[model samples]
Target chain A: MSEPQILIIRSVSFQQLDQNLPKLQEAFPGARIALLTHAHGVRQAEKYRAIHRVLAYPFKEGFHYRRRAADMKREQFDAVVIPVTNLSGTGFFNVLLFSLTIPSKRRFVCNMVSDIWEVSASRIIWMGVRHLLFQAVSSILSLLLGIFAVLFLPFGLKRLSKNK
Target chain B: MSAPLVSIVMLCWNRIEDVRESLNRIREQHYPHIETIVVDNGSTDGTVEMIQSEFPGVRLIRMYKNMGIEAYNIGFANARGEYTVIIDDDSFPAPNAIRRMVDKFEADERLGVVAFDVRNFYSYDDIKKEAETTDTVTNAPAANDYFMSFNGAGAGVRTSVLRQIGGYPEEFFLYNNELDSAFRIWDAGYKIQSFPDVVAYHKYSPKNRTSWRAPFYYTRNAFWTAWKNYPADMALRITIQLIYSCLYYSMEQRTTVYLKAMWSAFRDRGRLKGKRKPVERTIAEQLRVPWNVNFTFYR
Candidate 1:
């Protein structure tokens, strides 16, 4: 396969940015590497030699965040790498979203110990369907719980008042 | 007078090496009058045995099953120190960190928690390097502003305040327990602050770290924390916003963890019934992320 024209690395902490960036460069030779990270990490990310560009994800601004995602999609990255600690990739919802959004054919997830896997589009779709179903079911149950909470509100308030 | 007794409470689940390292660091603290407590969340590994044999002085609370963050409650109950330092198995304070944290608490009567600057490292060597190079005394101004919550990895809590708030919300099980406790602390008229000079190192090990559990627990506990602490109108508003956020993230991340967490939260709503003693509206407003900017994005 031909080398990617541009590559993006998305992470929450960007903890292994320094170590992972060079290895990624060797794998995707000549690819322009960009760092996509939380805004707080922008200054630290900028200091790295391997990162050709830095894109800070605005944590609080929904509209601006959407605009930033759209801008990234326009860049049309050839590959996206998400470094995760484990197979479940639990705290990486934002990273997963970015990888899917940027229109990258080669989406890779790696762990700190260097286990990397390519996530296929079909697999992504399957995961979405499965989890979305779970979410739907959970939402209904949660609504019921909310009703229960409302019912019990009086007692809770009484307890609070007693403590006061 | 001797330094007021500081209790170091750490939770371990099968990570024996990390726990051992943390305990050794605790033993090396520059501050005198410190007690260490280890709550083993039913480790199949030799964690319980090791703590018993190697660190007999440590107050070890052994459990038969992993109770997650709820296990900390047992440790807190047994804590004899005036201040309790809560940390994970893979985290520990700098030698002088406990001393500095105590100073902060003594300086401000309203201060309930003094958060440590938790530095994460992938390797033990790196942690050692950090310890060697870190400045124990600094003239640099620390951030004096009050924060909403403290990092669970490495933060100190006033034992009395912790007890007053009834420890952590046992219903939380794991994630977001810090925030739940923080809310109660704030409502009790105490402040939480982070000091850069007080440092701790987290191993940040990738091993045995579950992927779906964090998202699930975080999502579920977010609801509980809001419902249990926030004012009704504010809670409802935050819940609606959270639902939208979760829905968006679920579709985007292609994981049902968030939805499942929500469902579980709903299923367990009975636990929170009558548990709602909302914090003041002002406290809720100050602590909450503005709804408009709460949406997170990655470029």
Candidate 2:
């Protein structure tokens, strides 16, 4: 139980962190736990003194991911934990990115309803597919709406000018 | 040790010439500890090569595709400075703008954002005309430290403070992202104010953009902001107010664009639900709820 260090790559909101921190702390009472969360989580991280370190990790952009990965390599960790309940596309990317970026012996993705399980290659592939599918659908919807907006724009502008 | 470095971050789309001119303006600034970082969102107009060849000292992060307003997050990640000045491609800050904004932040530790007096560079008449026509609500002019939202084009933010509140709402995609981020900043116990003396001139072009998309984003994001930042009751009230305004514009202009905006907002209600984090009453009061009803920005 007396592990040296642990990292939690949090891609979730501050609220989720507030809910899950105690459980995490209880599970790893001996290890020094560090958190990688968004900038907004910094103030919130203040209350949880159990967590040894907090780094404001930008979870959205890939370029930042690379930068953070480089900065994170300075310290070695025994384990990395990811909460899966509030995971989004960016969150998934962060998990994949950090997994590659940081070297660790054990990696776990946890959820409230289930037990902690190690992330596998197939699981990452599945999440990636889901993320891509969602993105493709979103882009298609935007394109349709954009074309619709443009089609009706000429008449709208013309009428507005007439009214003015 | 030395003075805190300021990273002037310009989010450029395809305007290569404007980007070059804006860099020249940055070079003209009297400030000493400054670095220029341009986040070009997938521009095919030779913007990458131009910046690499000409502005060798400038740090450039090029995306393969246009990622909209969220592209600035890349610049924020790479920015090595105490303060990050957000700039638009066509917006030009005065020589002393950076010095003044940094000084303001130095004076007030709680100041999260400092918005510049963004005057339309075209003409006074054009400003007046914009005021009359646009449905967007511009910030009412104030004497000093007026509680208002940040203007993405010419606002200086403490880099540390920005990370605390998370960066700009990448979900906003395009317009109104500044206000969305500002609300979060306010909720984080930071002050966002207008520094009237610090000025930036915005070209506010009419031809370079597709004017049709402006109304759509304005309507949708205004409603989205109301929902995401307000309590349930106030959120509902503001949502209704926005719908009414959109309908009013739709009826007046005889265009479906406003309706499309309303529809888009309504359709995205579930997405809005996920992002909602109601601010404290104090912060919510500063939001100026009713003002966002017909809120329009000069594009």
Candidate 3:
């Protein structure tokens, strides 16, 4: 029921990081988000102050990936979403110091790369539907608990006071 | 001259520099017979002055205010060519792109359109991968392949086909107007094919991308485009894609717009119908084939 800090990493330059960020922000208000981008796209991150951080890296000779890993390690995000397509290959790996790991959510676009969690716009949507149902059920239980407290609690409190 | 090799209808708004660059390419064409017209969609960016001075020899049609994207239809109505080619001013076809596409029409009278491989400047890498190969829209007939794919940035269509199925819709100001046109051509017994070798590069601008209008019309028009063709299970396909889209994009604001677009398309279904020949493309009744594309609403 709480907002999760969504860490997003795509191969796109830093400039377009904010394009999808605002859409995410509108979906989850005040949600903490940090982008893992390349050095070229840093200006895009500056466009929004609400961005917790923008991690940039040099894209040659594997330097860019190291920066990406480092950003993930520093942020320690709740969950990550990568907007991948069949044409793309960027996928899961939670950030950590000295050691690399897989993301909490290992999803990518299906019909793209195989042997990985397939992610698509469809999955993002159904997850929201499931979330609403869970919240709705929990709300009903909270309501029942409030009713029980009101109906029988006055007599119970009075009896406890006399015993004391 | 020979009914003009191809009539060029350029739909433009504002960006004069981009169009001027494209017009330069058009002026250098090897084919001599041609008529080019620029339809100004009520741009306030001094596009009229630029077109007049820079593209002096070309004809110009100026609208008082933005008449939506259907303004191209006005230019099309006035076209005086046997074959009409619609290209956005931002995108430039190769010198021989028109000649190659026009050749296809001459090769086959029934060929309604020869849709060239419309490439964007950003997608050069993607195009380079297949530069060595030769590709055609469909080497076969329309009945053999079915009319499913189209891109309007660079393509030569028969003027007769335009009359047969009616021309482009005035409503879909930007996105997928070609797609809508493609289906109508197929339903009316004509064909639109993609010729891979006949390439047209879109020259995507760094400052201006087509996406500012994407979230609005792209999301909404996708389903509406399908609805215009598919009679049976359009609703189910749209609903499935809607859920599918949410999975990929985790933003409620974008999702809300997508849902609203579908709702609006349904409410305004009256506006879409009767504009062209009714086509049968719903998912339930669809005949799945190797080349037959599943036109799911992907915004």
Candidate 4:
């Protein structure tokens, strides 16, 4: 009704944010907007100089994230925007925040493919796929690291014993 | 004494039309001391605006994003009513539904939650046929002392008890959340009943819509619920059956979401130890007692 408080979550990259920012601003002209960019994109977002405030996602930083959430719970936003074109690792964090944060009335999942700002069910499906893919890849990597540590543990222990 | 205020908590997302219809139905109810709280899960279809402009009396809590079941926690925090009735956006209750549920609560102070007889709005003919068959062939129990869960769309929870157990578990982002709450209620020595006469109409639209995340949450939350509430032996057995069924469903649907869901559940198993408060073995057995075949929507 009045000036809407818009929160845009674009975690893909500064390039992606740059590409989408113009249209988003154009879509809601008088709205007071705040930006939550991925840590990697914070530098780019800070330089944009358009949004009222720019904040970096705490990501795996547990304590800071809780503080952020507590601070956010104090304020009410009119709309929350998720600009998703393709899935990236950072995009998953955006999705997690989307699941964690509570917005007022409007949630727009802006998909570049369809050039639409409406909530797309397909986008949810894609997010799940991307999330699992990340999980599978990370799990494999951890397993490999575990095997590497086991293979070298005996030699390192023997060397320590000899030195003693 | 004046009638206690009943707070109707509706968790809504982007189904603007359905939510409007549901709110209208609530307004049509005969209940006098009632308040409606709409927790909008970041709906982009002007749902908040519509509610503000049309139903000015309704309290609206807006979430910038969709927090799924966690929206209930947000609504519960602001709820000042003695009794809290949670209904889904796509569902609406019968005119007398609220009064009947409250009557049950009044009849028994120990009653914690009343699970309404939720019927499919679109399947009236089939439900009627099934009801007629059951009525003639069987003498089924009108109310179950131990309910598996309360339908989030059509259940009334005692506000004081809700606050005691710390509201709905926000960990359950979407699915099987009610079971978690139901178990805690039972553990707190409160009774949960399925009132057959108290009815609400659920459209059950998600069954037709394909969302891997829906099944994913169901599979994941099923195991999570068991781990958090059931005793060691019962939890193990139920989790095993759930995993097997999930595997079967995944194979049948040709989707890997179930496998992923299981992996996610097990990966997050570390948090269970601190949250676990296993119910009594006898109580767990009573809760699992299968009464008869009943059809639940796939969603």
Candidate 5:
């Protein structure tokens, strides 16, 4: 196979980049690495030696971000990697969404401890669906709690004031 | 005329090296009349001892436990300066930044807060390089001219105005407290402005980069801010937007942090009963940014 072009989506933390980028380089020898990060982080990311190109994801929505994403998709990277420092917590959702938007032949997820694994696009889509289901259920419960507060808090406050 | 006293209030919790450097930068400020206050949030890493020994002039308040952003209240209470500069343990103003902020306030009686140009750096060397090379301008426009909120990382508040608003919501713990205070400041007929000339460096430490607490508090406090400050209709609209955004984020991240935050916000909303004095429609319009802009830019 020809030398691969790899893109790494890192939201923050250069330390994570330091830890994970070398492993990626070792795994894909002679690969051209590009770093994509938040606009504010572009300056810092540029200083890293491993990255051949740096792409800034605009912090705003609308046409600019969409255009940028389209531009990245045209790059047609062979592999895309997301460096996640935390696995148990809400993984970097913004980074994940951005990664999914760009077309890549292979997708890899890496953690702070240097564990990298390839995940199928379908599996990621399934995770997204599960999250939506969970969110729907939670939203109903939250709305009920909010309704309860609105209905009962005034009375509680009035009684407390009378006691005072 | 003598320069108005500018009090620098900083919060520290176990980040000894960063705090030390921040205090040193404050000491180097050219602003003549200044007082420095450091609130130690029950740090076990000898941060308090270091501050006491090295910075003898700084007034230090020690909390028994980590009270989060609420500990800033103690520091503000003790501040005697006409304007108070709020900064994190890892943040500090440039030498002339405070002077420029004070001038901005002096020039505009309606101005209540002056936000610094907060430049975040991952390493101390980069911060030092930027500080040395960057030229200070005497006049600069507000970085976010239409936006009302000031960054808590490095912003100056008129003490009288801050007192009028009753300071930050103690229950917020952390995150979005600035927006809560900004709403009150605007409602009181004061403006919050930011200038490119007034710079502060924030050492964006890499540690604890992926904690769930940040997303949780940010989500929860955002709801409370809207509930307590926005007009009823505006609040409802913003609430719906926030819910949608949170749910979308939760789905994308495959985590329940947003759900928990919403639940917590609902449960603890009673704390905001008497505090719910929504701002006028004009102020609301002035403060409002498009939801997408707010989400992508700020959050």
Candidate 6:
């Protein structure tokens, strides 16, 4: 019934970009949102400009730490959707305890983290079934092709084998 | 010359003040016999003049241009002492750091590499305790924590072992250098050890932006390392990883960055392919990380 604000917490790839933004927009039709990204994610946030704010967080190896703390503390974001691999250290460590930091309510925590990072055993089993089907089909096709070749090979081989 | 217990071989480019601060720690050590070799990586910042004027006795191997990581090889080749340390110019070793590492190496012959804790240089004071203690934040013990995988930063590696393995893989150019070397070390039949108590400091610049060639190096080098070291059974995971990353990059509207990562991998894959070595591992452990995500240093 009401709009919900979000923070893109970690750095993630763009594959899930389209649906995530629009779906969130539709879910909270009139809700306002903001995004926080590392230097790499800034370019990505440009596409979904409907959100309130998009700021790039620097991650240089030689960058300053005081600046990192100030930035994390100074910022005001409701929900963070950080889809990054290694956006931890001072960055995530600081934001993990933000007053507004919802604990696994948004996709940031649900699918991207602990409660979200966990996978169901049934899901794993389903993945295994698909993997097996792929292997089985490939094997069956090769076997049939191998039998066809075996029957045809004797004609051409009979002359060569006789000479041998 | 009391046969110096250890020699620190550092590769530096510019960052004169950073280099000086790092060298000062070694010079101030109470340990009697230790050497410091600073390979000036073609620094125009007058770093050469500073080192000459200040640390006159410090071994300064001045090169005309950037020989890349090859400078490390030159430093290792010229090093003396029973153990040699490969330290980054920006990385500063703690007081008595080398002494502690050498003591451990001498105490254990099987110890191919000895690591001490490395805390963020700028945040060391803020994160010193967290870095020194073993916590869940990090999956494995920090190399700077005294006993890590013979990390390249603050670790004690036997001179004989390094010479045998040919030191760091010069072909790496940038990324995947450690894993490439680690695989060879593993193949050579020696255990890599970590020491948590021995702590040093790594003062990293806080400007971690994914710019220029960062994406290229990160994705490309990671894939290259995986292709080379992934057990044959685990080889296909490379494609899975690539697809996963590519799709994610695309969905995130970071297609350009993803493409750059792919290009970097393709361009530099030959080097990894050339050095590829098949590794032996138990079927079970190979399924776990450190088995896979072990060498993942995300950019």
Q: Output the number of the lDDT-best candidate.
A: 5
lDDT of 5 by residue, B72-161 (tens): 988999999999999999889978888888888999999999877666544323322243335533355433224457778899999999
lDDT of 3 by residue, B1-299 (tens): 26355788888888787888888888877667788988988888888898898879888999988776688888888788888888886877777677777777888887888776565544343313332234432233222222344666777788878866667877776676776777777776676665555667676433454323554566556655654555424433443444334233323223355445545654565565444233654322332211101111122
lDDT of 3: 0.55
Those runs of model 6 whose alpha carbons end farther than 4 Å from true positions after fitting are: A1-164, B1-4, B126-151, B208-210, B253-255, B272-274, B283-299
Candidates by lDDT, descending order:
5, 1, 2, 4, 3, 6
Clashing residue pairs in candidate 1, if any? A60-B293, A90-B211, A138-B263, A142-B266
Give the lDDT of residue B114 in candidate 3. Answer: 78
Clashes of each: 4, 8, 19, 11, 0, 59
lDDT of 2 at A43: 36
TM-score attained by model 5: 0.69
DockQ of each: 0.10, 0.01, 0.02, 0.01, 0.10, 0.04
Q: Model 5 Cα displacement at B60 (Å)?
A: 2.0
TM-score of 2: 0.59
Per residue, candidate 5 scores C-alpha lDDT tens digits across A120-156 of 7786777768766766865785586556555654454
Give candidate 1 regions above 4 Å deviation. A1-164, B123-146, B288-299
Model 5 / residue A49 / CA error / Å: 17
Per-residue error (Å), model 4, residue B112? 0.8
TM-score of each: 0.70, 0.59, 0.59, 0.59, 0.69, 0.59
Give me the displacement of residue B230 in model 1, in angstroms.
Answer: 0.8
Worst 10 residues of 1 chain B by lDDT: B290-299
Lowest summed lDDT across 10 adjacent residues in model 2 chain B is found at B124-133
Residue pairs that clash (backbone atoms under 3 angstroms), model 2 = A39-B163, A39-B164, A40-B164, A40-B166, B136-B295, B136-B296, B137-B295, B137-B296
Predictions in order: lDDT: 0.70, 0.66, 0.55, 0.65, 0.73, 0.54
Candidate 6 lDDT, A31-150, residue by residue in tens? 676665544334334434465666555542212324453455654434455333333311122233332323334344322111233223344345446545544653555455445434
* Model 6 Cα lDDT, one tens digit per residue, B1-299: 25446778898998888888987877776557778888887999989999999998789998888877778888888889688877888776767567667667767787777655554565344322243333222223222211113445666678888898888766655655665666656666665655445556666433533343444454555655555655544544453445354434333332355556655655555454345555565421222223222112233
